[model samples]
Target: MKKIGVFTSGGDSPGMNACIRAVVRACIYHGLEVYGIKYGYDGMIKGEIIKMQSHSVSNIVQRGGTILKSARSTEFRTKEGRQKAYDQLKKHGIEGLVAIGGDGTFTGAKIFSEEFDIPVIGCPGTIDNDIYGTDFTIGFDTAVNTALESIDKIRDTAASHDRIFFVEVMGRDSGYIAIQCGIGGGAEIVMVPETETTIADVIKKLDTGLRKTKTSSIVVVAEGDEEGNAAEVMAKVKAENPKNEYKVTTLGHIQRGGNPTATDRILGSRCGIAAVEGLMAGQRNCMAGVMNDQIVYTPFDDCISKSKPINQDYLKMMNILSI
Candidate 1:
């Protein structure tokens, strides 16, 4: 019987458990032994393995975060650690691997698969939605929803205080979350890494809004932006308009944990099953992603080499809505 192992690496996302459940169920349905690798690549290096039964994964598709938990490991970046992971895989008689994570984790998996000659399938699970090949990564919808809710909450305070608040949302290199939340929540200025924005331009916009509108303005800034930290930008804006009171809030890991929204749950299930199917169909060193509403397997080499570009339509929507 074919033996398969699944692990979640890097930062944990909302739909990871759903992906794991689909992987395990799909493997079992196909008469393969499914093993859960705990703590991601670190767990593999440490030989942490658990055989998963159907009952073990029951009702986890609706859950947030990873059932196996997740951690980053510099050891996993080294050849020695990869050798240990290979040794553990051989000891357990694992024939294939399903890796769920972002770019960094996929890089490690690509190295391991090449070095060990083991088939590995990847499922994108980052909230950042920056992974290549996939139009939407697991947890992105949930993260956008979580961030929008936080913005709504902060809006209540901002309105009462007549304040301008700079809110920071997570997105390493992509601005998916920031754009979506800013648009959904009707922010005054949306700052994203995808587009360049000068402090002068932002101030002019905010000043116009303050002078013309009674409602407090919201500026949604992606963590990785040209203007630096959202908090510092808020300070500068406040200094320029000392008469206008403002506040700053940074939504960090909170965006990474939450019940997977309906879209995330469905996407995770589809992508997870697609990962197993890719492996069984002899698609080696590829990642499973949804394109044009159909599952497709992309070579890991291409996935690691480039990232999915930020959706310009969504950016346009944000701009229109902000206006």
Candidate 2:
């Protein structure tokens, strides 16, 4: 408990630096030596750890992405790799750990915590917002806004050109960003992976709303929708409705970058401090998350095994509100 480590793994996300800042400062405030692990679990095996000071994390709260950096460590998947990482921790006297990332990060942390004597606490840092314990993940709000901003701009061009636009947002495993931006951008149709909506349905809706009545319109689709991304779906729709003008825009990693919004900074800060405090409280193999505006810890197994479902009402709202 006197010395601890923190690292960000898997894909990087906005507000992660704020989380790292909070974690480093909080540990230092509680009179614990903090170590920064670079390049995630891979860094542990490589012994790429450095002691952090109060100033180490200063002025990073406004920044996007993680200061500690993140990566998926293929080597860390093996038992031998994990043992090496454990030995390095023992060498550095790091008693506990705070891991930041999405489900992949938590899955690794859970296995490592169970295998070794060291304890670990995770922070949800994915843009997908699919983690079960918390109402929102660290980067989801920022990602949604980022994608929405693009949709707003695309809407202007969509109108100017008198064309239908298919805008793709992130979320391969979840449809959060697409659903949120779909409603917020006032799209004619929204497509997600969770629902039973089909490409045929999208085409029919375009015919009903875009082909005849409206000169321009938008359709927001998640990357993981049953048919395909925005481009593929647009192709199918274009083929069926040959007279309709169409354009495809994949928002891609633009949603992943950019400085986090005010909401994300607060969430990251809260989760970061909670993680450090949770470790001191003898809580292990769990995640620090904000549920209903209060800090709560959920077991890692539950966070990983249970999937957070999207609001069905949000999907339904699109049906009534969009038309």
**Top model by TM-score, which number?**
2
lDDT tens readout by residue for model 2, 1-323: 79999999998889999999899999989999999999999999999999999899888888887788777789999999999999999999999999999889999999999999689999999999999999999999999999999999999999999988999999898999999999999999988888868878987887787546688889998999899988999888888878878899999999988999999999999999999999999999999999999999999989999988889899789999877
What value of lDDT does candidate 1 attain over all alpha carbons?
Answer: 0.89
List TM-score per model, in order.
Answer: 0.97, 0.98
RMSD of each: 1.2, 1.0
Off by over 4 Å in 1: none
Q: Global lDDT of each model? A: 0.89, 0.91
Q: Per-residue CA lDDT of candidate 1, range 234-265, in tens? A: 87776676777778899999999989999999
Error of 1 at 86 (Å): 0.4
Candidate number achieving the greatest lDDT relative to the actual structure? 2
Instruction: Give stretches of model 2 more than 4 Å off.
Output: none
